[model samples]
Target chain A: MDIRKLVGGNVARLRKKTGLKQEPFSEAAGISQSYLSQIENGHVNLTLLGVNDLAQALGVPPIELFRELSEMNPD
Target chain B: MDIRKLVGGNVARLRKKTGLKQEPFSEAAGISQSYLSQIENGHVNLTLLGVNDLAQALGVPPIELFRELSEMNPD
Candidate 1:
């Protein structure tokens, strides 16, 4: 699976677990709501710091942003 | 702890675990040896895809590049 999609899914799932909408959650995340939308949609190649920021806002480990990853065979 | 440093340390350690020098390792990672050096030194804010690429090159899950990450308490 694509890493972006994986991250996006994890973020979305975690955000839902918080029961906060994108708008409020974006505020908590210190990013724009649209950016949060993009993030949930897997449209961003976020910087490492960006990932950390999101993880912090989400109250999860940065690695949680990449939960459920299986080793890929690079082609 | 800084996420970059954590990631850099993980990469550096994993690369060493492979017992390959920077030149060969960089080639496997499909990045310049100098770029690898920067990554290993925590001097780069690599894009999300870049992280995945590095993980693939290292023959590990992309998340392994972020192993040992403890959730940061967003300040």
Candidate 2:
């Protein structure tokens, strides 16, 4: 899959795993809801710091945002 | 390590691993040598597309660029 798609899916799943909706999560992540929507839709080409910012909001390491599902679970 | 430093070092080492100098490699990567220099120095914020671009230039998967040394080797 494309990295964009992979990242988007991961973001969506992780956000759901944390028990927060887009509004609350985006606020915690310091991004607007519309922007987070775009991110979750695989439409944004994020800056390196943007990756960090999102990861920080999600409490994951920056690299976790980049890994494939297989690499992430490894099981 | 900081992700910027991690990415910078990976770029430099991968470029070297492929036996290409910055000038030629940057030319092949379609980025200016100065920008490639900044990337190698960990002073730039790359877009997701930029990550894909650099990984393409290095002939590695995009996720490889985000991996640490240990992850790369696993040995």
Candidate 3:
């Protein structure tokens, strides 16, 4: 199902929806900009704590990142 | 808000709901039993890949773990 890519896509989408750049968003999330880029590219895995931090910074629930999974083609 | 505890509690609850011991479940999830125990205790951080793996093993969506956050006393 490539959940990592799905999650990464959603994170990037949500970040863009806020009209904030990776630098400011990563700073607000207490993560490095490079890490954020890796996350957006599905190149890195994240802890549950990281998910919470990013969600808080983005003004959303952590589960919001997975909201689109139902619509994704898991095959 | 102690998100770690909340998440740990949920993971434990879901695991118990299946009536399977940690050993079998951990094996199914491709993690060591000790590591699963730590996760159940909220003492270890998990990567996003870990979350997906656990969810797949548990036959649920990864977001299911966070579903109870709203009802939790965050203070």
Model 2 stretches astray by more than 4 angstroms = A70-75, B70-75
Better of 1 and 3 by DockQ: 1
Clashes per candidate (backbone, < 3 Å): 0, 0, 0
User: In model 3, which regions exceed 4 Å deviation?
Assistant: A69-75, B69-75
lDDT for each residue of candidate 1 in B1-75, tens digit (9 for 90 to 100): 788888998899889999999999998777899999999999999889999988988889888888773433343
RMSD in angstroms, all models?
A: 5.7, 2.1, 3.9
Quality of candidate 2 docking, DockQ: 0.69
Candidate 1 vs 2: which has more DockQ: 1
For residues B1-75, write the lDDT of model 3, one tens digit per residue: 555666677788889989999999898888899998988888877777877877788888877776665565576
Per-residue lDDT for B31-69 in model 2, tens only?
999999999999998888888889988998777777788
- Report the Cα lDDT for residue A28, model 1: 84
Query: What DockQ does each candidate score versus the true complex, computed on alpha carbons?
Result: 0.78, 0.69, 0.71
Off by over 4 Å in 1: A69-75, B69-75
Model 3, chain B only, scores a TM-score of 0.82
List chain A TM-scores, every candidate, in order: 0.87, 0.88, 0.83
Q: How many Å off is the CA of A46 in candidate 3?
A: 1.2
Residues A1-75, candidate 3: write the lDDT tens digits: 566776788899899999999999898888899999999888867777878888888898777777665565575
